[model samples]
Target: MSAMNKKRTESTETLKKVLRFIGRYRILLVVSIVLAAASVLLQLYVPILFGNAIDQIIAEQKVNFSQMWRWLRQVLLVVLFSGAASWIMNLINNRIAYRTVQDIRAKAIRHIQKLSLSYLDSHSTGDIISRITADADILSDGLLLGFTQLFSGIVTIIGTLVFMFSRNVVITIMVIVLTPLSFFVAKFISSHSFQMFQRQSSARGQQTALIEEMIGNQKLVQAFGYQDKASERFARINEELRESSQQAVFYSSLTNPSTRFVNNVIYAGVALAGAFLIPGGALTVGGLSVMLAYANQYMKPFNDISSVITELQNALACAARIFALLEEKPESPDPSESLSDVKGSVEIDQVSFRYTPHRPLIENFNLKAEPGRRIALVGPTGCGKTTFINLLMRFYDVNSGTISVDGKPVDQISRHSLRSSYGMVLQDTWIKNGTVRENITIGKPDASEDEIIQAAKMSHSWEFIRRLPDRLDTVITEDSLSQGQKQLLCITRVMLCLPPMLILDEATSSIDTRTEMLIQEAFDRLMQGRTSFIVAHRLSTIRNADEILVMKDGSIIEQGTHDELMKKGGFYHTLYNSQFVNTAE
Candidate 1:
């Protein structure tokens, strides 16, 4: 296909997709269209009442109040009816358009949740946020404005054409010649504005990302004296948006005036032509008056057409971005078939992964564990410990490896069911603003009060809960609790869920010594029957762990018990004695 044909075909497909997104709203859409048409037809007719009044009195020399009263009544009725129809049109259009936008947002949120780890790794949170929120708003505004104006413009143009041709064909034809010129104006403006508007939208998204980063890390910015740097970048993005938007506005601004200028020149030429007809007894004064009214009204539809065409380009740009997100491939293929009784057993063989294609973080890694085996993974920062747990959870798929639970391939199981088998507590855990009871027992909402308290006690969070004025009903959150308290509650949440397998990724790095010992006791209680993978930086916490794997550069360099590693005189022995053994002495 030729390049232009290819572009048109792609645009047609995009429009088809947008209409598909508006599925099931056909009834409301049809009704809105009909009401809008009725409103426009009535509005167009009401203006013709003046022409009738002038012709009745001026041309026929008849002074009749009944004729005038009749015309006045009809005009009032048309105005009232049009007003009612316009109201109905607006209500129905707003309802359906907003509903469609709401559905888009909800669907995008669900789709993002199902998307694979690689997809999220490729885009930032800010980019996705702008798509679901800002871009959807752009679509809604453009669609409603374009659809309503396009319909109203069409009706007005049709009415104007009928009236003008009925009065005098020669003058009407002279004016109609300028219609093609209006089209040229619209076409020129839309083409010039499309790419500029697209750039502005992109710049807006970048600005959103920068502002979000600033808000999320105000403390870091202050500590590093990076406010000036952050502000400079933000200003640059802001100016980029301003420049693109200004350019798009300037290009489109020509469309209206160019159209109106051509229209005015046509009007002057038509008036002169009509004057010749009037002297030759072909047209009267009333006829000339009526012609001008019809001619002026006819220009309105074309004016609106020009305006709506510009908005159409904007909607098209937003639709392309939205569809791009919708077309992204999600993480894993979720199974429609359900599997039950997922055992906590996990095994990884020959697994390799990297957050990016250029860097390989985990290579040829292998591990094995069954029910009731607690393995402690000890490694320095950035040593693939968290990546290991992420793989087991199937948050990410391995580039070349096999990881499974109960002999079922992780890819073959539904993501929901696969994730339900394990619970997690991380060092930098998030505690939403809610009561203590809500965070725990999140998996099982129907868990009884007794079960909630039991989970809290097992995680050693009960002591802090007892101190709260409301106990389980206390509104617990990071703002309300200390670091130790938040960790305790996070552990309590894991305990409440009672998953067969648990992952603690540096889960106890924040507590003081007194609370740390209590938390360790709680950890032992929580791990009584559950198989656990513990990622810990503090060597003392994993001293009694059943198996300890010492990792370096994503590979296990050594594996043994605490006493066994201390006797090996290897990397573990040197590191342990330097960091922990000497402190103990």
Candidate 2:
């Protein structure tokens, strides 16, 4: 197909997605429909009053004052009522549109929560936020304007035309001759507006990204003295946005004045022709008056048509983006593979994983651990220490091989359930701006106060917590925390979770040696009954583990008890000799 056809097809698909968003607001939408119809109905009566006022005096020769008063009062009443109804309809539409946007925000936020880590890694938070908030808002406003006004205006135009033709066909034909010009102008403007609006939406997203970057890295700007650089970047994006917005406005802005200009020309021409026809007894004065009124009515819908078409274009772009997001395939279907309990036992069998297809990390790796084992994975940097935890958690699927928790395949078990069974601690702690208790209970929302304190004690975090004014209820954030203290809070959260399996991926890498020792004691308490995987390069930390494995290039080359590995005269022996024994001696 040609490019134009493809564009049209894509626009239609976007409209369908937008319609689905509107489906939930059907009741309010229907009310909008009723009010629009009522507005048109009341509005349709004024022209008839003008025709009647002329017909009774000129055609029927009855100059009845009481009838004339009644007709004028009826026209005034319709005008007042139509104005009130239009105002109410606009109020309802604004409410409906605003509420629809709120729902979209809610849905997008929920979807973001469920997205996997891999997805978040591939996309920036600012971009995701723009899609939810700014993009969704554009869709709401654009659709609300396009749908409600387009519906009322088009209907009103048609009704007025029909009323005009029934009263006088000559003036109607004049309008009919001029109708093609109105549509031609509207179509031309709309087509240009479509392209301009695409640019407008693109610019809006770009502007949002720039603002987000500046906000997220304000400190970096100060640190690097990049205020001038940041200002230049922002100004460039702002100018681009302004240009695109002007183009969109220019196209839509042309439709109204151009339509009115054409109407004024047509009205003047028709009135002159009608004046000649009236002397020749071709048209009654009342019929000419009503036809002129309808001609004005006709120009309005066409004028609105131009604006609606432009808005539809913007809405189409937003709808397509939103639909594309909504249609994204969520993390692969995770089926239940583990029938029996986990029993805190795990084994990796000839497993290999690659972050990217070409960048093979772990190759043909195999390891086995007993129930309730405390295994430490030690290796130089760039080894597959962290990758192993990723596999066990199923954050990234293994390239080839099977991992099992309790002899059942990892992929076979539901990802949710598998993850739920394990407690993980990360190197960089994430402490939200909330009370200490709120952070701990985030892992287990209903964890009792005693349980929280008990877990905190196991992580050796309660010692610091007890010093706070409100203890558990005291707020702890970046504003209130030193790095080491924050790490303790994260550990406190993990301890409260107390899953059957624990994976600590450099969880204590940031803490001071003294705090590390205290944390290790707490971790030892926490690890007593569960199987734990500890990935650390520091030899002092792994000395007490039941088993120590030295990993390199994603595979385990040496594994044994600490003393046993030292006696083997292998990789583990070298790692131990280079770090621990040398430091001890």
Q: List the residue pairs that clash in candidate 1.
A: 115-331, 116-331
lDDT of 2 by residue, 49-127 (tens): 9677766673455587777778888889999999998888898888887887777678777776666677778766666
- Against the true structure, candidate 2 has what lDDT? 0.81
Best by TM-score: 1
Model 1 ranges with Cα > 4 A deviation: 1-13, 59-62, 336-343, 476-478, 581-585
- Tell me each candidate's TM-score: 0.93, 0.89
Query: lDDT of candidate 1 vs native?
Result: 0.80
Candidate 1's TM-score reads 0.93
> What would the per-residue lDDT of candidate 1 be over residues 365-478, giving only the tens digit for each residue?
988877777899987788899889888888888889898787777877877787787888899978888888887767889999999888888777898898889888888666
The true-versus-predicted C-alpha distance at residue 446 of model 1, in Å, is 1.1
User: Per-residue lDDT for 59 in model 2?
Assistant: 42
lDDT of 2 at 117: 70
C-alpha local distance difference test of each model:
0.80, 0.81
lDDT of 2 at 544: 90
Residue 200, candidate 2: Cα error in Å is 3.5
